[model samples]
Target: MATKNVLIVLSSHDLLGSTGRPTGWYLPEFAHPYYVLAPHVKLTIASPKGGHAPLDPGSVEAFKADPESVEFVQTKSALWENTEKLSTFLGRAKEFDAIFYPGGHGPMYDLATDPDSIALIREFWEAGKIVSTVCHGAAALTHATLSDGSYLVADTPVTGFANAEEDAIDFSQYMPFMLETELNKISGGKYEKAAEDWASHVVVAKEDRLLTGQNPGSARDLAVVILEKLNA
Candidate 1:
């Protein structure tokens, strides 16, 4: 079988809302997935403006004990240092077999409403390609709609950083909008979450090829699912 091409979109927004704290893509959310899929697929990393996608320092500190996350920072792989521009692939969704978003609070600020990102996602869904996200990465799906103008998640089983999870982290007030609230508003009862906060929860609407993970803990699991879908 031919190799699959996956586009990993990271956030360019680095500010953590009005708190004046720093935030970007979460370290493990991207690192764990990259390692799981890299050897088997072709991956391209991109950001809104191309170059130096920021990392959420808090995540780095929190997951510092994690070897993969540490290696990603200590080694400074070419992936995050020099990401291609997200807009550069706007009209080329067909060139990829899938698109993945690994989250941080930053995406809630930018990727959630980025026009180029939304268009690219729509193109992928319309092309019947896999659309995947983990944690707040699901923010990228908040504004995407179908060709008929209905929400893409309106009838799909989806999961994201839940309100409970957001509250547990105490970063809810610093958010532009609650990730769970927005996802629930548009999901039309299709949004799901684990019984408790921070638990691993992943949902895959196989028929639609829409896959989502509840939080950072679900990152590796989500990537494994992406691989399953890619190789199915």
Candidate 2:
């Protein structure tokens, strides 16, 4: 079997919606998947602006004691230090077997509508490759229209950072748009959440080749599932 090549896209937008707070790719969302895929596949990280994908400070401080998150911050600087621009991979979706988006509030402001990002998702989906994300990363899927003019997640069960979770953090107002709400609209009301708030929730729309995780707690588990799908 050939090695699976995956592309990980991060957000370059660091502002938390005019609140003057900073935000970027959430650490656990990226780290968990990184470690899971490191030993088993070829991975590449990219961002909209192409260099120094920012890490949400809140995540770094929040997951400060998590061994995986901490170790990632301490040792994986090189992985995200210089990413290829998303535009660079525009028509090259077949070069990779899959594409994953690690969420942070930043994507709400940028990746959600980036033409190249949207185009790439359509390209990958059309190629029958896996397309995945966790939490607010679903922003990247909100506007992706397929060649047939269908929203990629339409009618597919999917999960993302829930509105209730946003309410818990008191961040809903600062978000450009509600992640869960938008996903529901795109999925034709097929969006769902874990039974309890913040618990792990992953929705694998196998027929559509799409996978999504509900929140930070769901990141690692989602990666495991992705590995299984790739290995199978």
Candidate 3:
């Protein structure tokens, strides 16, 4: 079997919706998946503008004790140091076997509305490649329209950072849009949640080539699911 190449897209937006707080890719969301998938597949990181993808300060501080997070931050991995612009890889979607997006409040500001991001996702889906995102990263699915002119996520079972979770964190008001509410309204799919906030909850829309995780806690599970689907 050939080695599977996975593209990981991160958000370039660094501000947290006028809160005057800084934000970027969630540390755990990217680290957990990177370690889980790195040993088995080739991983490439990209962002809207390229260069060093900003790190969410809170995420770094929160997971600072975790060795994986520590290693990610300390190592000068080329993936994070030299991110390619999403626009430059638009026509090369076929070169990858799967694409993953890691969550942070930042995705809500940029990846969610980036034309190239949405187009690349649609292209990967249309070509039968696996597409996955976790937490607010699900926002990236918001504007994806299929060739038939229907929302790519329409009627597909998916999960993302729930509104209740947002409420728990007390940051919903600062968000440009409610992640869960928007996902439900746009996808028209059954959006399920865990009984407790921050618990692992993942939904795989088998027929849609889509996989989504409910929050940062579900990051590893989401990566495992993608690996299973790819290996099967």
Which candidate wins on lDDT?
2
* Residue-by-residue lDDT tens digits, candidate 3, 1-232: 9999999999998988877899999998999998889899998889999998888999989998999888988884566668988898887878998999999999999999999999999889988899999999999988988889898888778789999999998989999999999998887757778889999999989574699999999999999988888787
Model 2, range 104-211, lDDT digits (tens) per residue?
899999999999999999999999899999999989999989999999999899899999999999999998899999999989999999999999999999574799
- lDDT values, one for every candidate: 0.92, 0.93, 0.90
TM-score of 1: 0.97
Clashing pairs in 3: none
Which candidate gets the maximum TM-score versus the true structure? Answer: 2
Summing lDDT over every window of 10 consecutive residues in candidate 1, give the lowest-scoring window. Answer: 72-81
Model 1, 1-232: lDDT tens digits are 8999999999999999877899999999999998899999999999998999999999999998999999978885688989999999988999999999999998999999999999999999999899999999999999998788988898677899999888888889898899888888898777899998888999988485899999999999999999999999
lDDT of 3 at 36: 89
What is the lDDT for 179 in model 1? 87
